[model samples]
Target chain A: MSEAESSTAAQAVAPVQVHYCEVCTFPLEYCEFGSSFKKCKESLQKEDPELYDKYYSDEALQAKLGTLSLEAQAKLEKEAAKKEAKAEAKADAALKKKLASQVTIKRIERNKRKHVTSVHGLEAFGVDLKKAAKQFAQKFATGASVTKNLQGQEEIIVQGDVSGEIVELIEEGVGVLKGIPIDNVVEVEDKPKKKGGD
Target chain B: MFKKFSPSTDISGQTSVKSSVQRSLRTNILSQWKVDPETFDQIWPKKEPITLVKCREHISIYQLHGEPLFFQHYDGPLFPTLRLVHKYPFILPKVGVDRGAIRFLLAGAHMMCPGLTSKGGYLPPADSGLPAGAAVAIFAEGKEHAVGLGVLKLSTEDIKKVNKDIGVETVHYLGDDLWAIQKL
Candidate 1:
C-alpha cells in the first residue's frame, strides 16, 4: 500500500504522538489528535465525509462558509493563506533583524599611505571572521586578518582603503553566499559604486 | 664583479584563455600556494574572466576585462597572487635587505649578492628557505616590508657557497614597469 493508504489505519494504545491534518498534512496547532484516527484527516472526514467531499469540489474557500461545497474549503484556504502571510512577514522581519545587526564596515586611517579597513559585526550573522577576512584580503588583493577591535569584538582588518570594496562584497553577497547567513538580500540604497566589478 | 642586471622586455601581449584554462590556473595557483580550494573559489569565483597579458619571459599581467588584476610569474604553473604579498605576507619566502639597499631596489636595480650578504642584510633559513627559482618577497631591513618580488638564481646553500655577493637575481623589483604598470 502507498504511504497515505497505510497511514489510514488507526492503532490502539497510541503514544501521545503528534498528528497532522490529513488533507494538507499541516502539523499546525489547529490540527487535533486522538485514537481510532491516525490523523486529523480520518477524524474530520469520518465525522463529516460529505463536508470534506464538497469542500474539495469547491472553487474557492473564502467566498462562502455556508452549506456550499466551497464552505470548508474556504476556511482551510483562509487558514493556509493567513499562516503563509504571517510566516512571510515573520521571515521578512527576521531577515531585516539579521541584516540590521550592525554590519559595520569602517576604513580607519592608520597613517599616510597605510589605511586599515575593518569589517565588524558580521560574526553576529554566523560569518567566520578568519574565513571572511581571508576572502576579503584575497578579493581586494591585500593583506587582512581577524583581530580584536577596541571593543574586544572580532573584526576583519585589511591593509587598504577597502571601505568601498567591502561594501560591494557584502552587497553582492560574497560572504553570505558562502554560508555566511546574511540572507543575501540586496540593499537597493547602495551609494554609487566606483569599481564597476572586481 | 657584479653582473649588470638585464630585464627581459615584455612581449606576447594580451592573450585570453578559455574557461578551462582559467579553472586550471585557479586550481594550480591556489594549490601551489597551499590555499584551500573551496575558500579561493568562494573568494575569486570561476565567473570572473581573466586575460593573460604577457609582460616578461617568466611573468604575465592578469587582467579582468582589461582591468589588470595581478602579475603572475610562472615556473611550472602560474603564481598570480604574488603581487598581493603586501596584504598576504606568508605567500612567499621573505628576505630582508639593509636600509641602504632599499633605494637601489626600488629604483629597479638588480639585487647584488653583497646587498643580501652585507651588514643589516637577511636571508631566510637555508633548510626552510625557498627553493631556488621560487618567488621571494624582498623586504628592506628595519622597514620590514616587501620591496618587490624576486627569483633566486642560487639556493640559500649556493648563496653561502658563493659567500661574498649576489644571493638572488631579481625578477621584479619595486618601481619596475611591472610594479608601476598595473594599479592592482
Candidate 2:
C-alpha cells in the first residue's frame, strides 16, 4: 500500500517551496513564535507586503484565534513581547563585547635571526582559525597551523615573520578576514632577554 | 536529540561514505521514509557522495555539500532534519499540536497527549492511525509549515485513548542548535 502511494506521489507531486523570514530564519508563517518577531514582521512587510498581510492582518489574526481563548491569546502576546526584548538586549551586549575585543598579532624570536608570528584573539571576531591559517599558508607560501597558546586559547602560528603583512591583509578585509576592526588589531614584538649582560 | 549540538566540539569526524555503504543507506532511507524516488533524488543527488558526520554519542548526520539532510541516533529510525522536512514536508507522516503548546514545543518540550487531543490539534483517523516508534513531522495549530520532528512514543489510537503524558518524543525542533546551522 505504501509503495503504491509513493510511486504515485513520485509521479504527481513536487517539493514545496517554503519562504523563510530573513530576520529569524523561520518560515514566514512561524515568525510569530520567533524571538525577533517584530523585526521579522517589519522585514517581511517591506520585502513582501502581500505575504505580510496574509499572515499578520486583522482577518488572519481573527481566523488564527480558532480554539485558543482570548485570555490565552493575550498572555501569549505578552510573553512573546517579553521574549523579544530579552533577545534584543542579549544581542546588543554580544555586539558591544565583540567590538571591544582585540586581536593581537605577536612576533616571537625563535633564534638569533629567526622569528615566528602567532596571531591571537581572531576567533572572537568570528574568524575560523583553521581556514585563516590555511589562507596564510597559501598566501605566504609558508607553514601555518592553528595551535593552542600558553594561555590555553587557540591561535594561528605562521612559520615566517609576516606580522606586518597580516596586519595589512586584515585592515584590507581580505576574504574571511573581513569585519575585523582595524583599531582592535595590535602587533607586538617579543624578544628573549640576554642573561649575561644584565 | 539535537537540542545542544555544536559542530566544533561535538562532531568527532567526517568521512565520505563508500559506494557500497551509500547504496545500502539509500535503500534504507527509501524503505524508512515516505519519500518517492524523484523527490529523494532532488534532496540528495545520486552522483554526489554524502559525508557522514559522526557526532558525540552515537548520532550520525548525513550531509550533502555541507547541508545536513537526515540524522540517526544509534540504530533508531532515520529522521530528516527540520530544514529538509520544511522543504519536503510530505516525507513523513504528520501530527499536530494545539496553539497553546507552540511555545513549549519551541522550548524543546515533548508533545503531551493533551496538546494532541485538544480541539485545535489533529490526529489521523483510527483506521489509518500510525504505530508507535514512527517518525512524524510535528505541525502546530493554524500553521502551514512543520515546527519540529519527533518519534511517536505511543500509537495514535493509544494517544487518543490515554490523553495524557508525552505522546511524541521530540528529536529536533525549530530554533534548536541543529536548526541554527545552515551549513557545516
Please identify model 2 stretches exceeding 4 Å from their true place: A1-12
Q: What tens-digit string does per-residue lDDT give for candidate 1 at B1-184?
A: 0122222334566678789988877766766653344435533556877777765456666777655545655644334332345444454667776645655665456677766766667786666766677767787654433666677778866675686655666656543555434432
DockQ of each: 0.01, 0.55
Q: Residue B57 deviation, candidate 2, in Å?
A: 1.4
**Residue B96: error of model 1 in Å?**
1.3
lDDT of 2: 0.92
Q: Give model 1's DockQ, 2 decimals.
A: 0.01
Interface root-mean-square deviation of model 1 in angstroms is 34.4
lDDT of 1 by residue, A76-159 (tens): 456546655665678689887776676766666565456677777777677767788888778889999988877888877888
The prediction achieving the highest TM-score against the true structure is 2
**Chain B TM-scores of the candidates:** 0.76, 0.98
Per candidate, native contacts kept equal 0.00, 0.54
C-alpha RMSD of candidate 1: 30.3
Clashing pairs in 1: A61-A74, A142-B87, A143-B87, B113-B165, B113-B166, B113-B167
Off by over 4 Å in 1: A1-198, B1-13, B55-59, B72-83
Please give me the total number of clashing residue pairs in predicted model 1: 6
